[model samples]
Target: MLRVASVLSFFAGLVAVTIWIATALVEHAVERDASRRSLEWAEFAVWHVPRIDDLAQGLPSDPAELAAFEDLAHFGGVFRFKIFSPDGVLRFVSDDPGSVGSSLGTHNEHAVAVLTSGEAMTFVKDGREKPDRPDLYSETYLPVYDGDRLVAIAETYMDQTTKVAAVRTEYAIVGAALAGMILLALLIPSGSLWVMFRRLRRTNAELEEAQVRAQASDKSKSEFISTVSHELRTPLTSIKGALAMLESGKFAELDGSAKRLLEMALKNAEVLHLLVDDLLDFGKLATGGLEIRPCATDIAGLVQDEVDRIDSYDADRQVECRYTGERGPLFAHADPARIAQVVRNLLSNALKFSPVGGKVFVSVRERCGAIRVEVKDFGCGIPPCDQERIFEKFTQIDSSNTRQHSGAGLGLAISKEIVEAHDGRIGVTSAPGRGSAFYIDLPFCEGAAEAGAVELRNVA
Candidate 1:
């Protein structure tokens, strides 16, 4: 509203200035042309009238000259005409014969100037001062020169009310046209601004509505994941327990082929269990319900344990795991279970992507006040573009139906959440076909071994 008011005020001021300047220029031009025409008429009348020499001696008695002067004064919009002698004596009067031979006084400036300089002068009279002639008149004083000799001055007064009225009519017409143009100029932009304002309002309303819907949808999705994970847990737990019993020699009498089949079943069941667990963790993380239980833990021991576990799981594929870097205990304040989970996920990925007889290197060290663990494999590495997005839930580099990998692709996502919950960061560095290295950095906790007893002495 304030903006609209300001724009209107500005345009109003501009239109007023334009009209004032235009009117002033028009009035000046009209008045100047009128004065010139009045002077021309006065000069013509002076030429036709009795000679200035004759007027200097006495008023002309010629009927033709007197009649000509009378015609001009009466019908040519000329209010009056008079001839003054060089001595400032009024020699002739066209309107009033009785005013002839009168003394206009020696101090008459108009008559004195014309008689002395032999030049013309023109001016307007105030209408209020002439009761008989209420309209304004343009008076011209012209010197009638007798071949370079001073004679007399002829003064003529032309009524200017008609010319002024015509100029005023023209001004009225021009003012109306200019007003219309100014109004149009103001309205066009105003209308466009109003329309734009309306669109902005509508866009904001729609965006707000969409945000509400998106929030609701997100809540519903989290709830669904939480409920489904809970339901699948019961079945998954039973299947794993049954598979463990079978593998624990309860089926020792079974044939070799049957035993191998049972082992494969157990492996696949474990994978499914891990997927269900991942979903539950992701749902908790999404809803801000995930909790981190931090305690003084040996970071090197955790990485070694996870590396050994993954190596054993992939033993059939001839994959090997090697531990390097600082051999001494590197302590950090972290949730042991969550940190172990992150390490296990990285080791699993490295082993899965490695070829037969490939080696996975696990490194643990302390650098820059932080405990750093890295899992590197010389396998077909991730593309640079896909590396960043691989940790997103349900995203995978190989998503085609015929891809070699299994599972729902939530391992890295859950690992990322678990590491961050413990105030740590996890990331990957890789290039296509070169290799991949996944690293985790956690703030080092000094004097951790003295604060807590060693959880596991030998991680191998």
Candidate 2:
């Protein structure tokens, strides 16, 4: 508001200054032309009037001379005319006979200016003080020269009220136009800015509403997952227990195709249980309920344990598993169970993607004051574009319906959540065909640093 007021004030000042200058120039020109015309008339009277030299000798009694003086007084809007001798005596008065033969003072300013400069002099006088006249008058004085000899001075007074009115009217019209243009220049952009401000306010309101709705939808989805996971886990637990009993020969003896069918049922039930657990974990993570219990633990031992477990479980695949890194213990502040889960997930992915007889390598070491673990596999690697989003919930590299892989695709996502809860980071480096290497980095515990047992080593 202050800025707008300042702009208006500046524009008004500019207009006022422009009008003042223009009016001054026009008035000067008008006054100059008036002075020139008045002087011309004075010169004409001096040329045609009979013998002003005789008037200095005495008052003119000739009727023709007196008539000429009267005609000069009334001509061309002239109000009064007077003739002065070189010695400052008023020789003749055209309108006022009473002032004839009066001796003006030697210091009469107008007479002295005309005689010395030989130039016309003009001035204005207000007649408002007189009872009989109420108008402005312009007076001019010029010296009459009879062939390089100063003879007398002629003075004329002319009414100028009409010309003054015309100049004032012209100034008013031009000033109004310039003021209108300045107002228009300021108003147009101010109007556009006001409209844009309103639109921005409306857009901000819509965005706030959309954000509220999105948050509500996300809460509803998390509740639904939590409820469904709890319901499925109860039945899945019973089915898994029954399958375990049958596989253990506690319910019946199984052989041949019957034994194979029992094993398949047990495997599928376990997979279902794992899926239910994944769903529950996802819900807990979304609701900020997933937490880590950190303790000092040997990272190398954890990796070795997960590798041994995977080897025993997937013995039929005949895949090679190797652990090579720091021979000494690498300890970090982390949740042991959660760290184990993360390692297992990485190892499981490596095995799943590897060909039968392909190698899976697990390594653990200290790097940059932190414990680092890497699980690498010689398998079909991930595309560069897909690597970034591979750890998101339910995202699978091979997502086609007929793809040669199976699972709920929540392992990597769950692992990422658990690792982050322990203040660690997990990522993968891969290409189309070379292979994939998944790594975890965790901060070292104070105890591990004090123990002075941590060392950096290269993985074979």
RMSD of each: 7.5, 7.8
Top TM-score prediction, candidate number: 1
* Residue range 91-144, candidate 1, lDDT tens digits: 777776445233532336787877767666766555867666747667777766
Against the reference, the lDDT scores of all candidates come to 0.79, 0.79
What shift in Å separates residue 160 of candidate 1 from its native position after superposition?
Answer: 6.7
CA lDDT for candidate 1 = 0.79
- Write model 2 residue lDDT over 1-460, tens digit each, in one string: 9999998999799778887888686667556756887767766776888787666445545877777778987777787877777754566667754452435323367877777787878776678886544387777777776667777777777777777777777877877787679779878997898899899889989989998999889889988999999999999899999888888997788888998888889888877887888889889988999878887788888788878788864667888889987655777888888888788778878888898989999899888978889999989999999997999988987889999978878889999988887788999999888889999999977677556443433331
**Residue 113's lDDT in candidate 2:** 75
